[model samples]
Target: MLGSAILERRLELEVSQEKLAEMASVHRNYVGKVERGEQNLTIETLVRFAVTFKCKPSELLAEAGL
Candidate 1:
């Protein structure tokens, strides 16, 4: 649920998983896992993603249906 739209948003921004991971300061595999809904991310990771995407955390959460 959370991962799917995160993946979509990344694609909408034309960012690859590796690139998004780099931006978020997380491992590429971590990003992949998140995108695949294999990993449940923490608030810190969500914050990192929000920052990397230049959006509010609430926005990202909403987009991801979290």
Candidate 2:
């Protein structure tokens, strides 16, 4: 799922939720919610996450097995 991929990629990059959020211009709590699968993010937010993670959106989708 998307949550799992976010967790895996974040950990793989040794990035904290706060750091990711800062990079994505979102709240740390928002990042946490996304990672916990409690948030249904907008496309803009998803793109921000992809940019912050330095990966393509399709790559993220693939990693999430979507």
Candidate 3:
């Protein structure tokens, strides 16, 4: 659910996985895995994504209906 929200935000922002990874300071492959819901994420990673997306982590979670 969070992964899907992340993907949606990425698409809405017109960024590729590689770009989002760079912005979030994660590996491109990791971003792909995340979008596919194939990996677990740390809270730190979630914060990083929120920073990269210019939103709050809670907002992201809310968007994901978590």
Candidate 4:
């Protein structure tokens, strides 16, 4: 569910997974895994993604309806 929210935001921003990885300072493959719900994210990683999307971590969770 969280991964889906991230994927939706990434697509909405027209950003590629690779680009998001670069922006978030994560590996491209990690980003893929995240989007596929194959990986768990730490608070730091969650913050990185939220920063990349110009949102708050809570906002991401909210977007996921969590």
Q: How many backbone clashes does candidate 1 have?
A: 0
Give each model's clash number. 0, 0, 0, 0
lDDT of 1 by residue, 1-66 (tens): 779878887998898899999989999789889988999889999999988878988998888766
Candidate 4 residue lDDT tens string, 1-66: 899999998998898999999999999889889988999899999999999899999999998887
Candidate 2 lDDT over 1-66, as tens digits, reads 798898888898898999888989998798889989999888788888898789988888899888
- What's the lDDT for residue 44 in model 1? 92
Best by lDDT: 3
Candidate 3 lDDT tens digits, 1-66:
989999999999999999999999998799999999998999999999999889999999999899
| Model 4 misplacement above 4 A | none
| Model 3: residues with Cα > 4 Å off, grouped in runs | none
- C-alpha RMSD values across all candidates: 1.0, 0.9, 0.6, 0.7
Say which prediction, candidate 2 or candidate 4, comes out ahead on TM-score: 4
User: What is the Cα root-mean-square deviation between model 1 and the actual structure?
Assistant: 1.0
Instruction: Mark the regions of model 2 whose C-alpha exceeds 4 Å error after superposition.
Output: none
Model 4 TM-score, 2 decimals: 0.94
For candidate 2, what is the total of clashing residue pairs? Answer: 0
